[model samples]
Target: MDLIRQARARLAARLVVVTGASSGIGRAFVEAMAPSGARFVLVARRRELLEQLADHVRDSGSHAMVQALDLRDVEAGRAAAEEVLAHHGIPEVLFSNAGHSIARGLRGLVARPDSVTRSVAANFTGPVCHALPLLGAMCTRGGGHFIATTTVDARTSVPGWSPNVASKAGWDAWARSVAPELRSDGVATSLLAFPLVATPMLPPARRARARCAMSPEAAAEWVARAVVTRQARVAPWWLRPHELLHAAAPVLTARVTAPFSMRLVDRG
Candidate 1:
């Protein structure tokens, strides 16, 4: 079978939970997979947007349930996870695709420490909190796939992106650390280390300047590929080499890139 058919076969009538489903790549992924006959649990902060997407999914003859809440709230995330489990049973595929980003230097970070908390909540604690319940249930059931949408930036640190990179890196590390254990339980984990994508997550100026970035729909294709293939990671070809360079000479790499990174931030 072709990839599309394979994906459809795998996901057909299965329950798939997707965070950040109101917009961007998450929304696109839901739309792309709707034709596969999957039932989706859409989690995001915006009720209206989630409702609209749910309408679209129902129109396409798929099942959709929207859980609208801010992932930044740890309690809310936990509660939402339990609610999803109670309502939908354990999802066959849990796409943990929600994240938040903030660009701030040490000075700015010091001035606004809440940025760090917010970033950590959105990218690390929140997602983990939300996934823990489902993960346990999935393990009990003995077969599932967990896909995390991380960033290529998590591979290497950059100036002015500490909050974003650090939080994403934490999530990436957590997912990798749990992968072997999850595998033993017949649960697979895949991480998508994505490059810049044309989404609302990017600043307007950066989005406009991001000529090489993939579109949201294109990014969704990567997620679908992960769902179909269950690969450990999906990333740009150059990312591994870039990561090696940073690992080999962290100080030198940081020093060399700091100016350019700051310049971009200033421009943004």
Candidate 2:
């Protein structure tokens, strides 16, 4: 049972929207959240996969609507959210969990600007597209939860993959800015950042990064609890102090971690 289920009747009272619902963390999210007994809007690019996840969630006796769309397009966010509203009303929790990582850096992909741009839009701008309307609605409604699954890259900039770091950093800054505002209205806002996860988003050559990676199911369940319970922020508890230090002296940690990360990434 979910820790958020303590007030089952109250919590089950509204829909929840989770982006990146096709595979990895997204699919795991559908599975993790199914038992919460809330109507769900699952959005992703894989139509069949989303439908399959929907069937599985419904088998658990929960309601779900699967919409296949590309968040990179951004307009798709509005269309998908609008559909959810038309059928299920506003959601209680909005989860932005879709993202991918590339091990190679900009210098490595000099010829593929389009590819780099897509990654940036998907990892960063997608959250803004999905959340702006939801934020407005949730604020007006007086209570709701919003979660953005950022990357540890949001903190440490990678030389090779400037797009990923830059984009996710934008996401982190936006989330931080919005958190205080949302709290004033009783809406919980949180940003969950992960190191390399063992989810399918893990690139093969960089498999070493998932050495101590979190499982998709675990990430999903953890994030589900985060948005639902209104936990202010979450990361590995031990990292809290490090995060504080990172805030106080990002360049120091960046200089320290970069060489180590570079060597590891270079090895693969």
Candidate 3:
């Protein structure tokens, strides 16, 4: 079978949980997998959007349960996890894709520190807290997949996007550190280091400049590939080379990129 067929076969009739399912790549992913007959637990802060998406899933002959809550509320997130376990049982696949991005210089952040707090909560603490219970449940079940949507920015520090980059980097590191333990218990983890995708998450200025950004549907295909292959990490071909350059000469790379980074911040 082709990879798409393989992914469909594996996912058919399986219970899948997707965070940030209201729009963008998350919504696109659910739509792509709906035809495969996978049941989904859709999560996002928007109730009406998720309800609309759930209706579409139903139309595609798939089951969808909508959970509308902000992931940043740790208590609420834990409660939602408990509810998912009780109602849907343990999901065979958990796509922890909810994220927040803040593009601010240090000067701006010093004035509005709440942006940093929001970034850390949404990008790192929120997802981790929400997934903790489900992860344990999956471990007991003996077979499950955990997929996280990260960014290429997580691999390197960008001057204008410190909070967003740092938080995502923390998540990436945490997932990598826990992968071995999850594998020992028959649970697999995949971290997708996505490039700029034309999603609502992008700032207006960035979105305008991202003429080459991948569409949400295209990004969803990458997720499906990860589902089928259970790869530990999925990233662009140029990512490693970029990382190497930064690692080899961090100061020089930073100096060379400083002008561009300043421009990005200035635009926002």
Candidate 4:
């Protein structure tokens, strides 16, 4: 227990900036890590929830700040990052977890182009806007961590998740490309590929009985651990083998998973 306490103490000293902190895995992350002593900057669109979360964090004996900004606005993201830098100095950790998804299908994009555009901006471009300013500073400082949540769909497309798959794929490509460039400067970047978590983001119908879906707390624990340990990529144990098979025999893998994947599609 002494070793665990020491580890918690070390992790608690770092400042962590979390996007999407109003709820879900982000809230769980705040709950899991705040007691360990880490100060947090919580960013989200909902001001009320952010404040409530801030109160919770302060109650836990950790400092908490709230930033209410829509990430789809690139300039806003940059501005928020600057404010954080000015007020709190360079953050040791950035949990770039803000994202959006169109769960129905590509039809939603055709029916609602603006929503689709915002979703793409939120998942890919928005985080990059926030990250660019901080990454440069982290490079100069020679120490910092940038962690973002991704999904297995980034690599393989699912039946009703075209927008989500595309957005994640774009982010995965961009982040992976930039990872090596940051390595020389000692800025660690990680893309955590989560399969499915039982969060509000998942529809009630889907979340009702998804045995394989991880709890938000479980996902948050992995994310917090990754931030503390500076892990480059966090993925389930089974994901690698599936990725390998998909790479080795794309057609065969797709054929095998088609029925199963299609079953989860919401045809509305």
Candidate 5:
């Protein structure tokens, strides 16, 4: 057990790129892996927070490279990927965890096309924009690990989360379809179906329902464990039952979840 633990830590402590590194799960992942002496490329829009995390990573005796940019911009995401490749070389791991959510009903989302656009760009287009170049480089090198943070909403398509659900569903589908193809190129892909984690992304009411939600730190540790164990899917054990239920009866599952998800709607 100790050997396995040590090995996991060592494996996690390698050159890696993590998007959305400023806070929540991204920050926790950095903190959790720092002790293993992991070198990190922290990508996020917040310069100050990225610097703070870089300092924290450096303090832990690891190298930290900061790329402060919004992943929603395809040009910028590509530039950041290029810069990282130029300086740090291709990372052994790419954690495409950056995302955005809209707690608005479909009517509300339709009322403001701009919000829907941004949400889609952030949750779906952004990761792919940043990842394609990086993944190509990894394939050239003969191996790499790609971890994408997804959600149960993708499967259930809960109300008041149209943008979030659709965007993640697209991302999730892309990862699943490509995982097998990527494997032939020696690249491994993981689509992590996260049940609500207590992160800044969630509204106050949602965060209060703590039974099903994992702490960001716990989620981060789980991600690291997946990387170490080479697991293609990283999710809480409790989520399995929910997944099975959805698989067996998606419409019924959606009906059951609708009322609770409606609470997330921005009625105003």
Candidate 6:
């Protein structure tokens, strides 16, 4: 299949649930893909923003439904699934885009337990709590897609980013573990393990790396396409080389990456 055809074949006219749908990358996805004629479950604690997004979709002549959900809550996932299934189908696609990014180093992690809690909640367990219930239905339907955004951290580490790295590591593993199962059942799953982008999640140093930063809009477009195309997972075509370098030698890669940050956690 051609790239666009490959990317969106699975997602067309499907129900998509996007958590953290208020702004940043999540909003970018909705705005980018609205033309595709999909039903939406827009999840975020910010009702105002979600309503704004839904209004935008309606203005564009596409349909969107908003749900105010705090992803940190255990029930948010199930409630979202049920909401989508009620109006639409069992969400032919799920985007677990809610996440937390802390600009603290290891020492700061000790000082701030709450950051870890939020990070873990949004990055790891949130997706699990939400996606598991939908899996059986998707498999039975013989088609669906699950996608979550993981940062560059899971591939390597930098100063002041341990929690993000660790949280996304858990999230990444959760996606990978289910990927094969989903694939076998004609359901597709992927982790869009993105490189540093212009999303709100970026720290200043990471933002500086934005000399090459993908626009949230561009990133959103790629993700939307991937759903139907079923590439399974995606990163920049260029990231594979860097990912290979990290895979071969993490310590060296970490050392190299540490210098990229202005703040290094000097304490153990």
Q: Work out the TM-score per prediction.
A: 0.96, 0.87, 0.96, 0.91, 0.92, 0.88
Deviation in Å, model 6, residue 164 alpha carbon: 0.4
Model 1 CA lDDT for position 193 = 95
lDDT of each: 0.90, 0.73, 0.89, 0.81, 0.82, 0.75
lDDT of 5 by residue, 1-268 (tens): 3433453466555789999899899898888777567789999999999999999888977889999998899999999999888988988889999998777886776677777788889988988999988998998998989888998667655767777788898889888888887899999888778887899888776688767788997788767666876688876676678778888988887888889888758632
Candidate 5 lands at a TM-score of 0.92
Q: Residue 240 lDDT in model 2?
A: 63
Which ranges of candidate 3 are over 4 A from the true structure? 266-268
> What is the C-alpha lDDT profile of model 2 across 13-51, one tens digit per residue?
467788888888778767866765778888888899899
In angstroms, how far off is 259's CA in candidate 3?
2.0
CA RMSD of all predictions: 1.6, 2.9, 1.7, 2.3, 2.3, 3.2
lDDT tens digits by residue: candidate 1, 1-268: 2565677779999999999999899998888887788999999999999999999999988899999999988899999999988887889999999997788888787778888898999999999999999999999999999999999989798988888889999999999999998999999999999999999988888899989999998898898889889999999999999999999999999999898777544211
Candidate 4 lDDT tens digits, 63-105: 8999999998999999999988888888888888878766655
CA deviation > 4 Å runs, candidate 5: 1-8, 238-241
Task: Give the alpha carbon lDDT tens digit for every residue of 1-268 in model 6.
Answer: 2433444444467778888789788998888766556778888888999999999987865678888977778786777776666657787788888877765666677777777787788778876887777777888888878887877667665657776778889888878888888888988887787776697666565567568788887778777667756676777776678778888988887887776653644222
Deviation (Å) of 143 in candidate 4: 0.6
Looking at model 1, the pairs that clash are none
Give lDDT tens digits, candidate 3, residues 124-161: 99999999999999999898999999998787868878
Residue 255 local lDDT, model 6:
82
Number of the top lDDT candidate: 1
lDDT of 3: 0.89
Best by TM-score: 1
* lDDT ranking of the models: 1, 3, 5, 4, 6, 2
